[model samples]
Target: MSISKNLPMLSILAFLGLWQGLAFYLHSPLLPSPETVARIFWQHCQSGELPYHLGMTLLRLIVSFAISMLLGCSIGIALGRNEKLNAFFDNWLVIFLNVPALVTIILCYVWFGLTESAAILAVILNKVPNVIVTLREGTRALDKDLLNMAKCYGFSHTKTLRHVILPQLHPFLMSATRSGLALIWKIILMVELLGRSNGMGYQLHLFFQWFDIASILAYTVAFVGVIQIFEFAVLKPLDNLALKWR
Candidate 1:
């Protein structure tokens, strides 16, 4: 087997063995064995309760990620093309980047009254700056020679963009998308946990209230599985496309 497949299997086996050993040695209900967590996950899956909560969380993540990408890319492209605009937004971007996501989410809840909109807005606000930063750097790194050649050839703006700028921007855009999506998904979950009523985060909070560690692990595993799917099915394919020209 390849190292990639072998590594994951080995890690999982080691984790399960350690969990079983710990549970036996400690003899505590506080920390459920891995088997117990798997059983809990299976039971919830059979009842479809896991899917309901997981689907809702994924929906919120998608919505927030979409909004962040739209606004972030627009602003990034504009600022990248204009030195004055870049300078103006630099300080604001710094402030947003430095601000803790939890604080931002709490402030949104306080300002907007603990609603789903507030949760989404918090996630968007936290995520957009990073995307902007990445794309802005990409914009700054664009080849002047390519643009000058396009100008020399008297290419139309649309043609120049399609043939020159877009191909150059693809790598940067792909990087920004992958990084932004990963960060935003986690932040969205945290925002949901802090302020919302229906999501994996809320379910985690419910599990915490009852000190149900197995259920918490079950939810964590389910969410993580979804993230892996996104990385493989969406991000990986896009990465391959973006780098194909290279």
Candidate 2:
């Protein structure tokens, strides 16, 4: 437990040490020292460029994530609970699960005309199938005894779902949520880099054009720091709250 608690800081320090050693050994401009990257990161934050791009990325991330979760959960629950619906969508799910994310993004941009809507839609399309599969398995694994008890007590659908079904689904929901954040954020970066003109991905693309390795690494470290903060400060607490009974 002590190891688990300190693991984040320890791992980060170990990674930094490895990175510093690599930079010292390679002696290449492409692999700037961590100190150089840190300097660049400080410069960008002072100039407000990093904040603006990061904010835009966060907005896109939130919109896409919310839509994906809402749609994924609803469809997943339907497919999970209904045999006929599951049968009907099983092939489609398989196809989608196998479909390349790049193909979906390109198709959405082509069909929807390169708008914000298209970018978010692309992310949603790629993510929904995974959520559906996870939740379906969770539904299948639900305790039949609790379900029968709810039925025998004459529980309404909403009440039964809240009191009996959802408690069992907490683990699956948490799993899907954590996975979704990881994936959707990455997809958002791709969407932004490929089509949109703002966000960290676009900034990274610009830096790539100029071959500004330090700036690229700086933005990368900054964005990842933000994500880590969210995971620890927000999602970790939510996970504990949801799954504490288990």
Number of the top-ranking candidate, with lDDT as the measure = 2
Which RMSD does model 2 reach against the true structure?
Answer: 1.6
* Per-residue alpha-carbon lDDT of candidate 2 for residues 1-246, written as tens digits (9 for 90 to 100): 999999988998999999999999999989999999999999999999999999999998888888888888888888889999999989999999999999999999999988999998999999999888988999988899999999999999999989898888888888888899889988888998999999988999999999999999999898788888988899889888877777
lDDT of 1 by residue, 55-77 (tens): 99899888998989889888887
**Mind sharing the TM-score for model 1?**
0.89
Give lDDT: candidate 1, residue 123.
Answer: 92
- Candidate 1 residue pairs in clash (backbone atoms < 3 Å): none
What lDDT does each candidate get? 0.87, 0.91
All candidates: TM-score: 0.89, 0.95
Off by over 4 Å in 1: 1-5, 8-12
Best by TM-score: 2
Candidate 1, lDDT over the whole model: 0.87
